[model samples]
Target: MNKSRFWVVGGEYTSTDFETLIQGTERVVGPFETRGDAERTWRVLSEDHRPQAQVRFTIAHEHLTMNA
Candidate 1:
């Protein structure tokens, strides 16, 4: 079976603060081999936390195509 995983990390404070931010989101998908890998993935998706900002949310997506 094929599976997908997602990790999100965001905080206006510091990287460590992202841990608390994760608690309010969906449960993290597993099969993560190492904490460093997981952290790296999360950092990629993380955004700055701005509660009072006019634009409170942001979304980003990317597609990669490779030739064999």
Candidate 2:
């Protein structure tokens, strides 16, 4: 079965919380089932990226689950 999932990737911006797509320092994380899921994940990422004023998060659907 296809186990591909979506992901959330963005950059660290100390300006505003907006859509930066593929800009600034690159950061990728996730294999979420839905965009909303990824967005939730982004929150954690944003917090981890603290010290910055603004942060951007994006959803990317192109990851496959690995089975062992």
Candidate 3:
């Protein structure tokens, strides 16, 4: 059997330092099954935290697990 493992990654950066960073340092929430799931989490974080840096969420990577 093959299992799909997806991950979500986030990072923070402000306009003053936009060139230095592309994403947020904070991991909002992850390991969800689908993009929608990650998006939902990102939404919550966006609403809950109003940090000096902007938050960005993306599907970082996917891992394939094989089971015998």
For residue 68, model 3's alpha carbon misses the true position, in angstroms, by 1.8
Q: Considering lDDT, which of the candidate structures 1 and 2 is the better prediction for this target?
A: 2
Superposed model 3: Cα runs more than 4 Å off: 14-24, 48-53
- Relative to the true structure, candidate 3 has a C-alpha RMSD (angstroms) of 3.9
TM-score-sorted candidate list, best first: 3, 2, 1
Error of 2 at 18 (Å): 7.6
Q: What is the TM-score of each candidate against the true structure?
A: 0.29, 0.47, 0.52
Give one digit per residue, the lDDT tens place, for model 2 in 1-68: 35667787778664574545336588878678777888788778877777765656667787565766
Q: Please provide, for model 1 over 1-68, each residue's C-alpha lDDT reduced to its tens digit, 9 standing for 90 to 100.
A: 33333333233322333333333443343335455666665544443333422212222222335555
- lDDT leader: 2
lDDT (CA) per prediction: 0.38, 0.71, 0.61
lDDT of 1 at 39: 61
Alpha-carbon RMSD of each model:
11.6, 5.4, 3.9
TM-score result, candidate 1: 0.29
**Each candidate structure's count of clashing pairs:** 0, 0, 5
Q: What residue pairs clash in candidate 1, if any at all? A: none
